[model samples]
Each structure stands twice: as C-alpha cells, then as structure tokens.
Target: MTSQIHVALRPLWLCRACAAPWPCATARLNLLAEYRNSHVALSIYLAGMLYTAVEDLYRLNPQDAPKPTALHDRFLGWTAPRAPRPQPSD
Candidate 1:
C-alpha cells in the first residue's frame, strides 16, 4: 500500500460555499494569515505616524515641528528620502 499527501489552491469565494471541509479549510487558513500580516503592518505605520505627529505638535512652540528629527531615528533612517543636491550657480 502507498499513501500520499496532496495540496490544492482554491479561490476564497469558491471555498466559502464548499461543503468539503478540507477544501475550505486551507483557504481559510491562508486568508487568516494574510489578514494578520496586513493588520500588523497597517497598525505599525499608523502608530508611527501618529506618534511622530504628536511629538512634532509638542515641539511647535519652539518652531521645530516641520523637521524630520521629530520622528524616531530608526523610522527616519528607513523612510526618509535623500536630500536634493544644491543647484549650480550660473
């Protein structure tokens, strides 16, 4: 006797109406994982921006709100774009 394991990929809309548990099961699992990852990334980005904005507001009285230094160093290091080069004098 021989035994084998097989995996199948199915669309979520089809899987939802599937009567067989196995077919729907894997789809649900994958969908859940994808949702979790997206949620985490969204939460991190929102929190980072919110924190930075609040910090900048607190620093506004001193006229320091618009600079990049209000945000976390690590976030700034990762997301901040490079400065443009100075134009040459004619």
Candidate 2:
C-alpha cells in the first residue's frame, strides 16, 4: 500500500494527506521524530508556520480572525515537552 505524506496544503492550512488541519496528528508525529534532537529548532519552525497561518486565516476571514491562544496551542503547544507529574510524598 502507498503511504500518504502528511503535509500542509497552505492558505487553507489543512493536511494534504488526511485533509485535517495543518500539522495533523501524523504530521505532528513525523515532525517530533524528525526534530527529536533539536526542540528549539522545531519551535522556531513551528513559530514561523504559526505566523503564516495567522496571516492566511485572518485574510480568509477578517471578521472572525483565529484566536491567538488557540493558534498558539495548535501550532506550538503540542510541541512543548511536558513535565512529569509530581509523585505523592511517602
């Protein structure tokens, strides 16, 4: 079977393969694996994409621009390394 390459469709910010939002689940996993060694670099890349998404989405609907917090969570939040939960004291 042929593998689908999950990529951004641009302007629309949807996944080229799954038709989901850009940086869809598969794309996220691929990116995490691809940049496993350089998280800062990944953040920088995602930030740039966020900027472009904001511009494109806003232009598409200026009357209801995408929320900054939601976009931040979508583009960069998931990439953040979460801290382990603290264990209960003995």
Candidate 3:
C-alpha cells in the first residue's frame, strides 16, 4: 500500500501522515527540497498557507485562538532566507 502524504486535514490543519500539525518536520523538509531553487516562491507559498491556516484555526476556536506571533513563528519562522555567498578575490 502507498503511504499517506503529509497533507493538512482542513480546519484542524493536522498532518495526514503523522497526525502532527500541518507542515510538520517531514513536510517542511519536503517543501524545502521542492522549492530549493526559489526561496521567494517558498516564502510566498508559506505566507498563503499561513493566511489560510489562521482563518481556519481562528474560526474553529475563536475563544481559544492561537496568538498571532506564535502562528507567524510556526508558519514562517523556520524557513529564514539564505544569504548569497560572498565572492572570493581572483
């Protein structure tokens, strides 16, 4: 049988593969490999996911909604953009 893909499970945003949070470690690593050539694209994609997650999670439990900063950290913090390497003198 094929293994389940690590995808989000709707409003809950849990990973289908491991039942952890969506974009769990494995998912993040996969995303990095998929978007390795374009950090900007990765950032844009993650930002969109973050927006959707906030909407779904907040609606699911408005009274116990997660903090904005915490959500930002969880959704976008780990993928800090890489800086270009300095050139050596010839």
Candidate 4:
C-alpha cells in the first residue's frame, strides 16, 4: 500500500537530486529522510508533487539551461544526433 507508493516514487527522489532542485543539498536530504517515515508519507507525496512542478518550470524555461560543462556536453552528444564536420580549409 504505502510501501508500494514509496517504491514507485524512489526514482523520483533520485531524480530530484540529479536535477538539483532548490533548498540546497542538506535541506533536501533532511526533507527526504523525514518524508520516508510512514507517518510522513503524505508529506512525501506532497513533496513529489512540488518537485514535479519545479521540473515543469525548468521545462518551460529553455534560457535557464542547466549549467553547461564539458561532461554535460559529452553526455548530450551521446544522446543527440551528430552532424558531419567540415574539412579544414587549405
């Protein structure tokens, strides 16, 4: 019952970390741990809903792109279609 919901949402918890949602790492960790208790299941569900809203906001704002770095670029390159490079000019 509640356990099933927790299990289903475990990935979303990890996703929030990977996405680096607001409130900083320590605060997020505290929130997650607190929400794990059965008594706090409702809190967990609400947090998940809020996290979804945050992700939606991100999707809406292309200009607020995630901080770009070489590692991110490489990851994108792996997933994205590649174009042929032009030859060096003489």
lDDT of each: 0.42, 0.94, 0.90, 0.43
Top TM-score hit:
2
Clashes of each: 0, 0, 0, 0
TM-score of each: 0.27, 0.87, 0.84, 0.26
TM-score of 4: 0.26
lDDT of 4 by residue, 14-62 (tens): 3333343333355434545675555356354545555554465457665
Regions of candidate 3 where Cα sits further than 4 Å from its true position: 81-90
Question: For model 4, which pairs clash?
Answer: none
Q: How do all the candidates rank in terms of TM-score, highest first?
A: 2, 3, 1, 4
User: Model 2 RMSD to the real structure?
Assistant: 3.7
Model 2, 1-90: lDDT tens digits are: 999999999888999999988889999999999999999999999999999999999999989877999899889999987899999999
Show where candidate 1 strays beyond 4 Å: 1-37, 61-90
**lDDT per residue as tens, model 1, 1-90:** 653222222221122334442224554344345556575564465356546554555555446443445334423333334698899999
Global local distance difference test of model 3: 0.90
Model 2: weakest 10-residue lDDT segment is 59-68
Clash pairs (backbone) in predicted model 1: none
Q: After superposition, how far is residue 87 of candidate 3 from its true place, in Å?
A: 28
